[model samples]
Target chain A: MSILVIAEHDNAELKGATLNTIAAAKAVGGDIDVLVAGSGCGAVAEAAAKVEGVSKVLVADNAAYEHQLAENVAKLVGDLGKNYSHIMAPATTTGKNMLPRAAALLDVQPISDIIAVESPDTFKRPIYAGNVIATVQSSDAIKVASVRTTAFDPVAAEGGSAAVETVDIVDDAAVSKFVGEELAESDRPELTAARVVISGGRGMQNGENFEMLNKVADKLGAAVGASRAAVDAGFVPNDMQVGQTGKIVAPDLYIAVGISGAIQHLAGMKDSKVIVAINKDEEAPIFSVADYGLVADLFDAVPELEAKL
Target chain B: MKVLVAVKRVVDYNVKVRPKADGSDVDIANVKMSINPFCEIAVEEAVRLKEKGVVSEIVAVSMGPKQCQEQIRTALALGADRGIQVETDAELQPLAVAKCLKAIVEKEEPQLVILGKQSIDGDNNQTGQMLAALTGMGQGTFASEVNVEEGSVKVTREIDGGLQTVELQLPAVVTTDLRLNEPRYASLPNIMKAKKKPLDVTNPDELGVDIAPRTKTLKVEPPAERQAGIKVGDVAELVEKLKNEAKVI
Candidate 1:
C-alpha cells in the first residue's frame, strides 16, 4: 500500500501544518508521496523532497491551481486516485474543501479530522464538538481522510532526500472564479504553529486591551490568540479564535489570561505541553487543564509578567 | 430565485456529552436538542436574503427520525417558507445525506442551496461539498460573508491564513461559518404561525436514495482527561516551575 499526502502550501513556501500531516502519513506505514498542487510552487516541492520519510514529491504547476480551488484540485487528486491506497491532507480549510469532493468523485467515503490511526481502515476522531471521541472503520476500497495536525508531532523538515517528479495539471473548471483574498498580517508566528501562545478572553473588555497580551507575547516571542468569547465580543477578529468551532493549537507553552476556559475553548488548546492559566475566577474550567494555575487579576499579572520577561 | 437550506438537529452545544460504558455510542437518552449552530447561521443568512427580495421562496429540509420535525418547524419559525423532512430512523452518513439532498434539489430546482459547513454531531464537513459534486454544481464552503448578485453569488470564506472571496455561478452550494451572522431567536408569534406552515414528510427510499451508513462505529470512548495541577502562590513560583521543570520559557 502507498500513501499520497497533499502538501499544504503557498506558491512561495510550505505551511507548517503539512509537516504534522506528513507524520500522520508516516504512521499509516507506507511509501509516502507528497503532491504539491499550486501555481509556481516548485520551491514547495523542493522543500517537500527534503522532509524525512517522503519517497517522492509530485509537483503540478499551472494557472488553474493558482488558488488551489476545490473544483480544480479535487479533479487533480481524483484523476490520480488510482495510484495510491490512502490519500490524506492536513485538516485545514483547504484540505476540508478539496478532499471530500475528491472522495465523492472517487465514489468512496471520506473520514474527517482523524486524530489517530488504529489501522489502515479504522481511525479515531472527535465528534460533537470534541465531547465524544468515536472510533470508525471504513469499508471502502480507497481510504480518504484529513489528519488533525495538532494531534501528531511534526516530522523533521530535513534529513533524507526524495526525488521530485513533475506531473501534468488537470483541466480548469470554469464554475467558480477567485475574486481576491484578505489575509491577516502578523509579525508573530501563525497561531497553530506557534511554540508559545498567550490568549485573552471576553474579560479583556475591548479590542484595545488585547495590547496587553500582545506585549507579553512580544516579550516571549509568542503568538497572540483569543477565545470565541473574545471574538464574539468584538475584542478580536474571528480568525484569532481558539476553540472547537475555531482553530486548534497544541503549542509547547500556552498562557490563558482572563479566559474562563469553556469546554469548546478547551477542545482546541488542552493538548499544549505546559499550560498556565491566570484568571480572577478560581472556579474557571481552564484551571482543570492548566499545569500552573494562578488565581490573580489578568490586568495585574499580564503587565507584571511582561515586565519580568 | 429560490433558496434551499439544510438544517440538522443535534445535542445542544452547552451539554458535555460522554460515551456509554460499553463503548457502543454516545448516550443521548435525555439531552436538550437544538439546531446545529452553523445550520442556524445558514437559516439566518437565507432569511436575510429573502427579506432583501433576492429570494422569492425558502425551502428548508432535514433528514432524521420523526423527532427532527421539531427542528424543521424551528426552521419554519425562523423564516423558511416551507419544510421537507426526509424521515429515517437509521443513522445516515455524509454521502447518504448528500444523495438525499441531491434528490430533493432535482425536484425543487432551487437556484441556490445553502447548508451548514458541518453538523456538531459528526463534524464530517462533507455533505455540502459532496452534494455539489453529485449535482455538478459549484460550491463555496466555510462562508463568512455571502452576497447575492445578478445570476451569481460572492462568498467570503474563512480559510486558515485569512479570508478568501470567490464568485460562483447560479445553482451553486454555499455553507455557513460562525462569523457569518448572528442567528435571531424565533418570536412567540412566529413560533405560533410556524405551526400552520406546510411541512411535508418523506423517506430516502421515496427520494430514490439509500440511507444506510457508509462508515461503521467500531467503538466510542471518552478522551483522556487532563488532571488538575497545583496552584502557584505567586509569580516567582510560577516562573520557577517554567524555568526549572517545564523549561518552556
Candidate 2:
C-alpha cells in the first residue's frame, strides 16, 4: 500500500512529531511519501527526505501556504491525497486543523487520533478522555487518520535518501489571512518531545509557585507543564495544561507535583515510562499510577529535591 | 449578522465511562448527561457577541437522538435566539454531521458559525473544519479569542507552540478552545423561557444528507493499568532511586 504522511513543520525545520508519524506509517507497512507544504520550506523537505522509511518527499512551496492555513493546506492535501491508500498526519494542532477538512473533501470519514495500528484497516484510539480504548475498522476505500505521536517511537532522523519532488499545486483560498503569532520562548525543551517533564497542579497555588517546578525541571533539563486545574485557576497559561483536553505528553520520566491525579490529567501523561508523584495528600488518585510516590509537601520537597539533584 | 452555534450532548465530564462487557460500545445508559464543555464555551461566545450588538440573532443547532434537544434547550437558555435539531438515530460521524450542518448553513445563510473544538465523548475535533470545507468557508480552530470586525473576524488560536492570530472573511467558522471565556450558568427564569423558544426539528433526510457509518467498532477495552510503585521516605532517597535504579535522570 502507498501512504501519504503529512510532515508537520514550520518553514525552516521539521517537527519531531513527523518522525513519530513516519514510525506509525512504517507500522502500517507501506511505501511512504512525506508532504511538506509551506512557503520556503525546502529545508523541511530535505530533512523529511532523510527520515528513515520515507520513499519520497513532496514540497508544495507558495506564499498561500506560508502560514499553513487550514483553508489552503486542506485543499492541497485533499487534491493530492486522491492517489494514496491511506493519508495520515501527526495529531498536532495543525494536523487536527486540516486533516478532517481534507477527509471531508474526499467524502471519507477520518479517524481522530489512533494510538495503535492493529492492521491497515483497524486501529485503536482513546475515547471518553482515554478512559476507554476503542478498536475501529474502516470500511471506506481510503483510510484517513491522525497518529498520536506519543504512542509511537520516533524513527531515525538521518538515515534515508529519498527523492524530493516539488509539486506545483497552489491553492490560495483567500478566505483567510495570517495576522501574527506569539510563541513561547523556552530554553529547556518542547514538552511533548522532552525526555523528562515536571508538571505542577492546583497545589502550585499561584503562577509564581511554578518557579519551584522550574528549578527542579532545570536541574533535569526537563520541560515544565501544569494540570488543567492550574490553568483553569489562572495559575498558568492554557498551553501549559496537560490533560485530556490539552496537550498529551509521554516522556521517559514524568513528575507530577501537587496534582490531585484527576483522570483527565492521567490521560495525558499515563504513557510516561516512569511516573513520580509528590503530593501532601496520600489519598490522591495520582498515587495509583505513579512509579514512585512521595507523600510530602511539594513546597519543601521540591526545593530539597532540586538541591539533591 | 447572524451566528450559528453547534452543541453536543455527551456523558458528563466527571463520569468515568466504561465499556460494556460485550465490547460493543461505551455504556451510557442511565448515566448523567450534559452539554459538552467546549460547546458551552461556544454558546457563551455567541451570547457575548450578541451582547456586544455585533450579532443580530443566534441559531443553535445539534444532531443526535431525540434527547439531544436538552442540549439545544441549554443553548437557548444560555442566550440563543432559536434552536434546530437534526434528529437522527444513525451513528453520526464527523463527515455526516458536517454535511448536515452545511445544508443548514446554505438555507440559513448565517454570517458566522461556531462550534466546540472537540466533543468530550468522541473527541473527534473534526466537525468545524469539515463544515468549513463543505461550505467553502474559512476556519479558525482552537480559538482563544475572537473579534468580529466590519467584513471579517480576527481569531487568536491556541497552537502547539503558542498563540496565532488569523483574520477570516465573513461567513467563517470558528471552534472554541478552553481559554475562550468562562460560561455563565443558566438561571431558573431563563430555563423556563428557553422552553418557549422556537426549536424546530428536522431529520437528515429532510436535509438531504446521508447519515451512514463508514467505520465499524471491532472492540472496546480498557488501557493497560499502571501498577503503583513504592513511596519514598524523603527527597534524598527519591534522588538516589532515580540515579541508581530508574536511571531516568
Candidate 3:
C-alpha cells in the first residue's frame, strides 16, 4: 500500500506542518508520495522531495488551483483517489475545507485529526474536544484524513534527489470565487504550528498591553496567543483566541498571563507540555492546572518575566 | 436568497468537564447548555442578511436529543424565522450529521446554508464541507465576512498564511468564523415574540437518514499534565536559562 500526502503551502514556500503530516504518513509504514496542488507550486514539489521518508513529489500546477479551491481540489484528489491506500494533509483551515469534500465524494469516512497510527489502516483520534479518544479502523477502499500537525514530529530535510512528476491538472469551474487578499500579521508565528506560545487575557486591560506578552514571546521564540475574553473585547483578532471557540493548541511551553482560567480557555491549552500561569488572583482556576503559578500582577510580572527570560 | 443555519447544544463552556466514571465520555451532568457560539454567529449573520433585504428566510436546524428544542427556540429568539430539530440520540460523527443536514437541504431547497466552522464539543469542522459535497454545492469555510448578491455570495475567509475572499453561487454552504459578526443577544421583547415563531420538530427518520454513530469512543482521559519549568527574573537571565540550561533555543 502507498500513502499520498497532499502538501499544503503557498506558491513561494512550504509550511513546516507539511513535514509533520509527512511524519504521520510515514507512521503508516508505506511508500509516501506527496501531491502539491496549486498554481506555480513546482518550488513546493522540489522542497517536498527533500524531506525524509518521502519517495516522490507530484506537482499539479494550474491557475484553476491558485486558491486551492475546495471544489477543484476535491476533483483533483478524487481523480487520484484510485492510486493510494491513504490520502492525507495537515489539519488546517485549508485541509479541513477540502479533505472532507474529497472524502464525501469518495464515500468514505475521514479519520479526522489522527493523533497516532496503530497500523497502516487503523488510527487513533480525539472526539468531542479531546473529551474522548477513539481507535478507528477504516474498511473503505481508501482511507483519507487530515493530520493534527501537533501530534507528530516534523521530519528533517534529508536532502534527497527524489523524482518530481508533473501530474495532469484538473480544471473545475465550479469554484468561481476569488479571495481578494488577507491582512496577515507577518511578524507572528503561525499559531497552528508554533512550538511555544504565550497568550494574554482580559486582565491585560486592552490591546496595547499585549505588547508585553509579545516581547516575552519574541524572547522565548514563541507564538503570541490571547484568551476569548481578550478577543471578544477587541484586544486581538479572533484567530488568536485560545479557547473552545478558537484554536486548540498544544505547545511545548505555554505561558498565560493576566488570564483567569475560564473552562473555555483551559479547554484549548490544557494539553500543553508545560503550563505556567501568572495571575494576581490566588483563587483563579488557572492555578489548579498550572505547574507553576505566580500570584503577582501581570503589570509587575510580565516585564520581569521578559527581563528574566 | 433563503438561508439555513445549523446549531448544536454542548456542555456549557463554563463547566469543568470530567470524564464519566466508566471513562466513556465527559460527564455532562448539571452543565448549563447553550447554543454553540459559532452557530449563533451564523444565525445572526443570516438574520442580519434577512433584515438587510438580501435574504428572505432564516431556517434554523439542529441535530441532537429532543432537548435541542431549547437551542432551536434560542435560535428563533435570536431571529430565525423557523426551526427544524432532527431528533437523534446517537453520537453523531461529522459525516453522519452532514448526511442528515444534507437531507434537510434537499427538502428545504434553500439557496444558502450556514453553520459554525466546527462544533466546539466535537471540534470536527467537517460537516458543512461534507454536506456541501453530498449536495453537490460549493462551500466557503471559516468565513469572517459574508455578503449576498443576486444569485451569488461573497465571503472573506481565514486561512493560515492570511485571509482570502471568494465568491460562490447560491445554494452554497458558509461556515462562521469568530470574526464573522458579533451576535446580538435576544431581547426580552424578542424572546416573547419567538415563542410564537413556528418550530417543527422532526426525527432523523423523517429526514430519511440513519443516525447510527459512525465512530465510537473507547476512552476519555484528561491530557497528561505538564512538568513545571523555571521562571526567571529578567531577559538576560531568561536568555541564560534558554541558551545554557533548557537549551531549546
Candidate 4:
C-alpha cells in the first residue's frame, strides 16, 4: 500500500509540522510519498524527498496550484486518489481546509485532526474540541485523514533521496481572484514554527502591558502569543490567539503570561515540551499544571529577566 | 442578493467533553447543544451583509436529523429570512454535503454562500471549498473580513503566517474565521418573530442527491492523560530548571 502526504510549506522552508506528519504517516501502514503542489516548488519537493521513509515526492507546479486553494487542491488530489491507500496532511488550517473537500470528492469519509493511528485504516481524533476522542475506521479503499502534528515527533531527513514526478491536472479552482498579500511583520519567531511561545491573557491589562511579555519572549527567541481573552480585549490580533478554538501549539517552551490556564487555552498548548506560568495570583488555575509558577508582578520580573537575557 | 448560510449543531463551546465507552463518539447525550461557533460567525456575517443592503433574503441551511431544526430556528431567530432542512440522520461527509448543497444552489440560486471555516464538531473546514468546486464557483475560506462590492466580494483570509485578502466574483462561497464578527444573540422580539418565519423541511432524497456517509466510527475515548510535570518555585529557579533540566530554553 502507498501513502500520500501533503506537504505544508511556502515553496522555501518546510514547516516542522510536515515532518511530524511524515513520522505519523510512516508509523501507519504503507510506502510513503509527499506531494508538494505550488508554482516552481522544486527546492521544496527536493527537500521533502529527503525526509525519513519518504519513497517519492510528487510535484505539481503550475500557477493555478500556487494558491493552495482547497477547491483546486482537493480536485487534483481527489482525482489522483485512486493510486493511494491513504492521503494525510497535518491538521493545520490548510490541511483542515483541503482534506475534507478532497475526501468528499473521493466519495469517502475524511477524518480530521487524527490523534492516534492504530492500523492503516483506524484512527483516533478529537471531538468537542479536544474533550473526547473518537476512533474512526474507514472501510473504503482510500482513507483520508488529517494528522495532529502534536501527537508525533518530527522525523529527521535520511540520506536517501526520492524521485519527483510532475502531476498535470486542470485547475478547477475558480475561488477568489488573486489579491494583495500582507504578511504579518514581526521580529520574533512565527507562532507555529517557534521553538518557544509566550502567551498573555486578559490579565495583562492593555496593549502596552504586552511589553512585559515581549521582554521575556525575546530573550528566548520565542513567539509572542495571546489568549482569546487578550485578543478579544484588543491586546492583539486574532492571529496571535492560542487556545482550543485557536491554534494548537507544541513548542519546546510555552510561557503563559498573566494568564489563568483555562481548559480551552490549555487544550491548545498542553502538548508543549515544557510550560511555564508567571502570574501574581498564585492561586490562578495556571499554577496547577504549570511546570514553573512565578508569583510576582510581571512588570518587575519581565524587565529584570530581559536585562539578563 | 439572495444568500445561503450553512450551519452545524454541536456541543456548546463551554461544555467539557467525555468519550463514550465504544469510542465512536463523545458522550453527548447529556451535554447541551448549540450552533457551532464558526457557523455562528457565518450567520453574523450574513446578517451584517443584510444590514448593509448587500443581501435581500438570508436562507439558513443545515443537513442532519430533525433535531438540527433547532439550529435552523436559532439561525432564523438571528435574522435569517428562512430556513431549509435537508433531512438525513447520517453524518454527511463534506463532499456529500457539498453535493447536496450544489443541488440546493442549483435550485435556490443564492448569490452568496457563507459557512464557518470548519465545524466545531468535525473540525473539517472542507464543505465550503468543496461546494465551490462541485458548483464551479469562487471560494474564500477562513475569512476574517468580507466586503460585498459591486459584483465581486473581497475576503481577507486568516493564514498561519499572516492574513491574505482575495477578491471573488458573485455566486461565491466564503467561510468564517474567529475574527470575522462577534455573533449576536437573537433578541426576545426576534426570537418571537422567528416562529412566523418560513422553515421548509425536505428529505435528502427529495434533493435527488446521494449523501451516504463514507466513514464509520470504530470507537471514541478520552485522550491519554499527561503526567503532571513538576512545578518550580520562583522565576530564577524556573529559568534554571528550564535551561538545565528540561533543556528547552
* Candidate that scores best on lDDT: 2
Model 3 chain A lDDT-worst window of ten: A126-135
Candidate ordering by DockQ (highest first): 2, 1, 4, 3
- Rate residue A133 of model 3 by lDDT: 61
| Residue lDDT tens for model 1, A1-309 | 899999999999988878999999888899999999999998999999999999999999999899999988888898887689999999999999999998988888899999999988899999977878899999888899999999898999999699999988665878899999999999999999999999999888999999999998888889999999999888888889998878989999999999999988998998889999999999998999999999998888888888777
Better of 2 and 3 by lDDT: 2
- CA displacement after TM-score superposition, residue A136 of candidate 4 (Å): 1.0
What is candidate 4's CA lDDT for residue B26? 68
List the lowest-lDDT window of 10 residues for candidate 4 chain A: A169-178
- Model 2 root mean square deviation, Cα atoms: 0.7
Writing each residue's lDDT as its tens digit, candidate 2 over B54-167 gives 999999999999999999999999999999999998899888999999999999999999999999998889999999999999999999999999999999999998999999
For residues B112-164, write the lDDT of model 4, one tens digit per residue: 99998877776666788778767777778889999998888999988776788
Clashing pairs in 3: A179-B165, A307-B234, A307-B235, A308-B233, A308-B234, A308-B235, A308-B238, A309-B238, A309-B239, B111-B171
Better of 3 and 4 by TM-score: 4
Q: Reference contacts recovered by each candidate, as fractions?
A: 0.77, 0.92, 0.45, 0.68
B1-249 per-residue lDDT for model 1 (tens digits): 899999999999888888998999999889999999999999999999999999999999998999999999999999999999999998889999899999999999999999999988888999999998888788999999999999899999999868999999989999998999999999999999999999999999899986666689999988888898989987778888998989999
- Which candidate wins on TM-score? 2
**lDDT: worst 10-residue window of model 4 chain B:** B226-235
lDDT of 2 by residue, A70-125 (tens): 99999999999999999999999999999999999999999989999999999999
Better of 2 and 4 by TM-score: 2
lDDT of 1 at A159: 98
State TM-scores per candidate: 0.98, 0.99, 0.92, 0.94
Superior candidate under TM-score, 1 versus 2: 2
Model 3, A120-220: lDDT tens digits are: 77788765556456666676778897898878988987666679999886758574577597666657677776878899998999999999988988887
**Which of the two candidates, 2 or 4, achieves a greater lDDT against the reference?**
2
* Candidate 3 wrongly placed segments (more than 4 Å): B210-212, B227-249
